[model samples]
Target: MISGLDDVIAAETMLSDVDGLNGRLVIAGHSLDDLAGRTSYEAMLALLLGEFLQADTAAITRNLAAARREVHAYVEGIDAAILALSPIEALRAMIARLPDGEDRDTAYRLLAAPAVFTPALLRMQQGLPVIAPSETLGHAADMLAMLLGTVPAEEQAKALDTYLVTVSDHGLNASTFAARVVASTRAGLTSAILAALSALKGPLHGGAPGPVLDMLDSVGTPERAEAVLAAELARGERLMGFGHRIYRVRDPRADALKAALQQLAKAGAVPAGRLALAEAVEGAALVLLRQKKPDRALETNVEFYTALLLEALGLPREAFTCVFAAGRVGGWIGHAREQIDHGRLIRPQSKYIGPLAA
Candidate 1:
């Protein structure tokens, strides 16, 4: 038996392909290169959800924008203590509060949760008023506006869009699989999404980006990248952003986000020096990783540049995982619906080895 069920073929999907060997990702039949660089988060959401929900793009966009507003009323009614929970916990609570209806409108409402709940919780943590989502703004733009209490600049907004698109979906990741498992029980969309959020909160799944920023803070200068990485390597700690379980080569999403950061730098949205510092650290990490583990290729992965781009976008490190949930909820919903339509319960058998006394 494979430990942790490695190489287990649990389910077949069409939502996204994580081509780890080739370091590529395809979403809904489009290459990551093609989709992430140009697609709006709404467009991708419409595309992914349309297959299962039978809703047109216009309807999806309208319903999602409306849902963003609806979630605010939901957010407003929550107890302040509940809002004080950690980002993922707060998101799970707010989602549990949404009415349970297994339909397209509920799907839209579920998709809007992270976009609304994350920034609201962050603002509450800062003792600032929670900014409401603009029904007119796109998903990424409105999310940033709520976090910052103003309209995001065009370039900054576009960078956020790219980050969202890049992370929207990836095969049956742990979080997506959790969503599918819950949906297989014919649970409500909110229930399935809450399961996804729970899985995402685990450090192994959606928790590395914040620590990447921490590594940068500890390094403090471009010249120290090598020493810091070497020290960490010598201590036998796994580097936060360098390796991936699936990708044998570099992660394709990392390249897309790195490019987005470069674009923001070119547009004068992010400081080139910050981007350069990250690049220096990445270069040092890659070299050291290869040198130390010659048998394994622990190349740079998505969280490396995710931290950089989100930092440039001015997102708090604490909220990074929630922002990721904002992007990935679309994929979770799609997979959940697909699992439900396929009509199979996800009940896996376990090998019993605990001293049978028969």
Candidate 2:
């Protein structure tokens, strides 16, 4: 048996492919390079959902916008106790209120839940009123508007959209696999999405992006980057954003987000010093990693630029993973449907190494 199911192929999908050796990703028929900055998140959702269902970009966009408005009501139930928990926890609690089903309607609402709940939870935690959703705006734009109580610039909205589209799907990742496992069991789309969210909450997955910001904060400036990273390496602490379980070279998503960050910087939306320092730290970390490890490809991954972009988008670091969920939920729902349509129950055998019975 393959430990941790490494290199195991469980299901066939037309969704997304991760090519680690070559550092490439394809979502549906589009290359990540083509999709990330060019395609809207709604359109990306349309592309993924089209694999298993019939929906156009405009219809999917309109439906998701309406669903966001519908899910906004669930935010009213986020009481003081819920606000006391972390943003992701609060988001999860609110999502549990959504009705569960495998229908297209349920998929839309599940896809929309995190976008609505995350902003409201954060606003309420900061003693601010929850901004209602806008039917006129697209998913990424409306999320930023609700979070900041102001319409974001076109560039900022596009950056968030790029992020959503970039991460919409990536083969059978931990969360996606978890989502598909529940889906294969005939669990509804909402149940599958909740399983994905639970998997994403683990630090090894979506929980990682927050700490990328923390690492930057600790480094403080570009000049101190080498010394700081060297110390971390010497202490045998893993540099948070610099390595990947796949991708022998740099993560392609990192380049996608770096381009977004650059575009945001060009628009004067991101602080130049912050961008410069992150670049410096990234350079330093790459050099140090090559010198120290020599055998491993500990290049910068998605988390590095993700931290900078999300912070520039005015997301509190604590809410990073929630936003990640807001993007990935579409893929989760689509994968759930795909499993329901064409897959069997996911059961793998274990090579028993425990005590033998007579």
Candidate 3:
């Protein structure tokens, strides 16, 4: 058996493809770069949910936003009490309150819940009140506006859109797999999303970005990057953001986000030397890591620059995963709907090696 179930092809999907060897990603029929800054989040959701969502685009957008507003108000009512909970815990609580059902309307509400809960959890971490959703705004833009209390500038907005789109879906990731499993059981959308969120909260899955910041902080400056990385390697510590499970080459999302970060830096939104320093650190770490572990292909993954980009966007380290959930919730809902339509329970057989019974 493959350890950790490596190279296991469990299911077929029309969602995003992760081509690890070529460092490429395709969402639906479009290349990630083609769709990143070009389409709005709602439009991308439409593309992913085509034929599966039964609702018209206008209805979907309106109902999703309305659901966000409803969840936002609900979270605000308990903001003080849940502030003591971790962001993921608060997010789970918020998701748990969504109305339960498998109807189209319930699907729309489930689709919007994570977008509302994640940002609210992040803001609550900073002692800020949750911002209500705006009917006048698109989902990604509204998320940024809510987090900052003002609309983001054009470049910032575009950057967030790109980041969100690039990560919208990947085939059978742990969280997506969990979502599909739940949906296969004919569970409601809320239950499917809660399963996905629970999987995402695991460190081995969606919890790498915050550690990227910790790595950057320990390195302190560009001059120390190589030495610190070398020492970490010597100590047998895995560099937090340098590798991925699927990507044998570099992660395509890394370049997508790095491009957005460069745009932000050019627009003077991020500090001048910050991107350069990060690039240096990444390059040095890659070279040194290759020399040290010849058998392992440790290329830079998305989390390396995801942290810098979100941090540059003024998000705290604690909020990185929550922001990830914000972008990924759309994909989760789409996948859940797809699994439900496919009409099968996802109960895979497991090989047991623990004990033998007579």
Highest-TM-score candidate: 2
| Backbone clashes (count) for model 2 | 0
Q: For residues 156-238, could you state the per-residue lDDT of candidate 2 as single tens digits?
A: 99999999988899889999999999999997888888899999999999999989889999999999999998999999998
Please count the clashing residue pairs in each candidate, in the order shown. Answer: 0, 0, 0
Model 1 misses residue 83 by how many Å? 3.3
Give the clashing residue pairs of candidate 3, or none: none
lDDT of 1 by residue, 1-358 (tens): 7887778989888789888889989999999999877988988987788866677767777778898998788877667778668877877888888887668878888888889988888888788998988978888899999999999999888999998889899999899999999999987888999899999999999988999989988888899999998999999988889888999999999999988888888988777678777888999998998899999989989999999899888898888999999999999999999898875999999889789787
Please give the range of 10 consecutive residues that has the lowest summed lDDT in model 3.
50-59
Error of 3 at 288 (Å): 0.8
Winner of 1 and 2 under TM-score: 2
**Candidate 2 Cα errors over 4 Å, as ranges:** 51-53
Q: List the residue pairs that clash in candidate 1.
A: none
Candidates 2 and 3 compared by lDDT, better number: 2
The candidate maximizing lDDT is 2
Residue-by-residue lDDT tens digits, candidate 3, 1-358 = 7886678877677877888888889988888878877877777777887566755567567767887776676675655667787877777877788787777667667667767777777776777776888987777777787888788888888888788887889878999989988888887888988999899988898888999889887888899999999999899898989888888888888888888898999899998677767877888898998899889888988898889999988888777777788788778887887788774897768889887887
